[model samples]
Target: MPELKLLLKHKARTLDEYRRIGGYAAFQKALAMDRQAVIDEIKKSGLRGRGGAGFPTWIKWNGIPKQKTKRHYVLCNADEGEPGTFKDKELMESTPHQVIEGMMIAGWATQADVGYIYIRAEFMDCARAVKSAIDEAYAEGLLGKNIQGTGWDFDLHVHLGAGSYECGEESAMMSSLMGERGMPRLKAPHAPLPTIAGLWDSPTLINNVETFACAPHIIQNGGDWYAAMGASTKNSRGTKIFSVSGHVNKPGNYEIEFGTKLSDLLELAGGIKGGALKACIPGGSSVPILNAESVAKAVIGYEEIGEVGSMVGSGGCIFFNEHTCIVALMWRTAKFYMRESCGKCTPCREGTDWLFQIHDRIIKGGGRPEDINLLKQICAQIDGRSFCGLGDAAAWPIVAALKVFPHEYEYFIQHGKSIVDTPQSKLMFPYAEPVPV
Candidate 1:
């Protein structure tokens, strides 16, 4: 198989071009079949959400009740805000019809009348591309009332978010689409599911961009055919989009069969740039960090990544070669969560700030080993104690980094500088003149 799959050679940015490539064929097939069969096909495809959670797509669509609702909605989460993750943006910008086709089919399955593509504020070009695609779909009668004359009155629109990472959360995205502050809502009775109640109290089916993008293909090909493309694991199967960033020579999105080893991906990415690999954030910044050696055996999927105490979250593999200070990297990561904290819960809001402060001290070369222990304690307290996943997400990397690089951290504390970044008996950063303590 080639390095890239879905978006490669996919020049179907518009409805006409997309149709030429069998764009609406899946949706048409979906309309002709029983809704349950379509859902079953998705299940057999083994497609999971590409937006971090990796939740089974078929199960999520099945969560919607079959009963009639006044209004049902399909929302595409295009908020690609995770640090070092951009697979969705590439898919959306390049293969807009894939998403459109997927959403149309999902709407048909759940009887949704409206669909919205909620893109992040930072993806201005992607937003424009998606909006234009929507326009083209509407113009050619592929969208809007009675799509392809199948009596499926689905209307699609693009709604751009205001740059809040919290909006990446499903409920929060729903809130934002309904004109709220973009903070997550308590998941109880849920966001009034798309089959029963969603936007304006209607049943809503919200799926990530990549998750939807995979749908048309799954529907077009038999589910087993799609599932056979990747790892044998039932937990997380099929191809995934991994965004390699940081010290890699080729840092971009690469679609690989699930369970492809991290080492192979690094090699495919042209290896670490200018230095030996030190550590890697296997998933997005929210996931745990793996030391270089651990990542050596790690694979690019949920199961293998979990074996090494990390996740393939959103498939963002950020490499940090030698000379990259783990303490400094963590401090930078902590600061991102701190600034992005929505302050919805006390633990996340207060704990993130505290974690940032401690990491800040350690990175500046003025903290004790107790600070390391304290950071772990704070992360443990924050996990599973906050209102949303953001709190837990912020702490996973902190704890993972400590577990993998304790010695480096201890060296930093005792010498008042990173082992790689500072030189001296104990008082000088390598990049600057000696400092008197």
Candidate 2:
């Protein structure tokens, strides 16, 4: 109903303040219990991955081999590269210890010998905050050998990537972490699951920053306690932090419980700014765009959002006002994906460029009559044909825009101008440099 600040409960800046606000209490409670019990608590909590894919968190934790024959490693994906998403960055910056404690709990649950936080290079402030928190953790015997005298040991490290969006993918992050190119590897069925063979061919557990940040909470409050929060949704449980941006008046991160209305999130961000809401990308740039009609009925759960023809992807909710031009917005989005494509596979490498070319021409008033169908055809070809999700990510928004705003493309192509014929809409592409006389 309102902002549920489970993870963002306190803006605790230091380890001392964090402890005063009951920060590592969950990790301490976890230490006294069996590792299976720790994971079982997560299982009962019904917490899903806070990353784009809402996979069940406990399954990944439990997937690690119980025998522990080889070294186990835990990985935190701090590379927040999704456009319109900044929740993970805020989590790392504001409550660094919360994230560290969560990872430590994961290390204990999975019998991990070491853990690494793969942060983006641009997040230097977040890196320094987390690094300082880690230093504080070691000084207090909360980390390193014989942690808290439980005879269990875990070493945590921070790694910064060279700011590649492709590395945000789990396998790609692992590749970059191992000093390889920032490209994706063959996933399950073709290769072993990351849990079975990741980061130097050993058992590894990888979860994003927000997913790990939820661990401490789940461990502290019993599983049942966490599960009850989002009972209104079919399966989505607990709270999710959404990074609201674009036309919202007070754009920032707002944590809301599952089953909250999508419109409610907009209101929490202080409503639309320049004009009335026209459309919204309920997730990150990669998810389908929802028209205002759909947004009104959309609920903030994984399945609920899907029912409205979008996904709760990465919790990057971007609202577009009435003055916005859907075609121009999509053109910019296409350009981003095209530039960020890793070029690892033929479908994505070649297909993304094609998509950007089409959008570029259309937005520049050179669109052919068949350009709309061509865009759809290209999206179909690249949706699932590529090596990884990047292809799908590149294709989804284009496909959604075409479906949701068909008239925009049709009118823009037919008249060589946006149908939203407003002075504000003309200003949308202000970056177009003046032609020299």
Candidate 3:
């Protein structure tokens, strides 16, 4: 494996060690140029948000209002709630300076005076590490006021999220930061385009944790350097952190360039632990599932996966080998979304429970043939129609599982029990785990 350590390496949390590696050089470089020039550089670099949306960073920055405002905020979203997506926590805990430096450069580009790192409550350790790095930057005057004596003052604070997946949505994050419940806001008001109204009526730019971490490298090496690291897809550029889990032997994070084969990523994880490669969840549990043959051909970038009927959402590669029962897997995966559903919209709130019911009936050996079609139709209705991605998120595994393993589902309906004919079902469901009736 060609291990080019840009985001994962570096033990230094202090400004001095970060400086030794040409860290803040980007911030310093950005300070010398006009804001639009910096934005142009990011556009040229082909940098997209690493938090799964893959939106162009330059477009987001440029979307901010240029008119004079009393306050503007640059918020780094550290709420890594996607299942199997721990890459952000790794970057934050291991090489925090990169994230801080990147955010400061972002703040400089956007003319934001204040920045906040809204971290998940579960990631307390990463929060501590990042907060410590922030303190070190402040000591070196890298964070607070008149940065590098350029008369550009930017201050950063770390805020803790109450730990909801919906908070990962940028608008919900803003509302939560304002001491409101962590529910996603409608897009029409649209975060006011991050230029007009953000974080208490100021221009605010909120980016995922890893998105900001990639900035210093782009700034230091020039946009071309970062752009050339991955596939020539319009949006997928630079390295991606794949947090491999499930049946994989080496279930940990693997930092590889974009466009790396899904099979190669699984090999990096030492392949599936015991069973034959049955299925894979290329993104988090949110994106659709890919069968074994398709997994072998799947590439690691955003546009690459889009061609294969799935998305590269959050880079959480979950492997499920032969011994895994699809009905049982769907049951558990649906249960996660049902539990984590913010209960906001009708489709997500009600449909999540409906999915749970269908999967529960199937896994318990009471499925009907028509239930398969029902699952697909229900998921289709939920995928694009819900309030946010969570509806789609809850629907993905169900539809994907049905698409790839229709026969396995059929066998369950025919037998009126698990095809495996094992006693493990009882162990899998200890008690009647209640889903909405």
Using lDDT as the yardstick, the better of models 1 and 2 is 2
What candidate 2 gets wrong by more than 4 Å, as runs, is 430-437
Candidate achieving higher TM-score, 2 or 3: 2
| For model 3, the run of ten residues with the poorest summed lDDT | 422-431
Q: Against the correct fold, how does model 3 do in TM-score?
A: 0.94
Candidate 3 structure quality by residue, lDDT tens digits, 1-437? 66556788676666677778777778878888898888888887888888888888898898777775578899998998888798998888878889888888888888889999999998888889989988988898887777788888889999999778888888788889999998887774543565567688788898888889888888878888888888456468888888899888889888888878889888989988866898888888888888888887887778889878788888888998777777888888888888888888998898988898888888777888899888988898899999888888889888888888888899988897666544533345532765554
Pairs with steric clashes in candidate 2: none
- Model 1 regions lying over 4 Å from their true place: 1-4, 7-9, 189-196, 422-437
Candidate 3 local accuracy as lDDT?
0.83
Top candidate, metric TM-score: 2
Better of 1 and 2 by TM-score: 2
The TM-scores of all predictions, comma-separated, are 0.93, 0.98, 0.94
Candidate 2, 269-361: lDDT as tens digits: 999998899999988999999999999999989999999999999999999999999988988888888889999898888888999888778
Which ten contiguous residues of candidate 1 have the minimum total lDDT?
Answer: 422-431
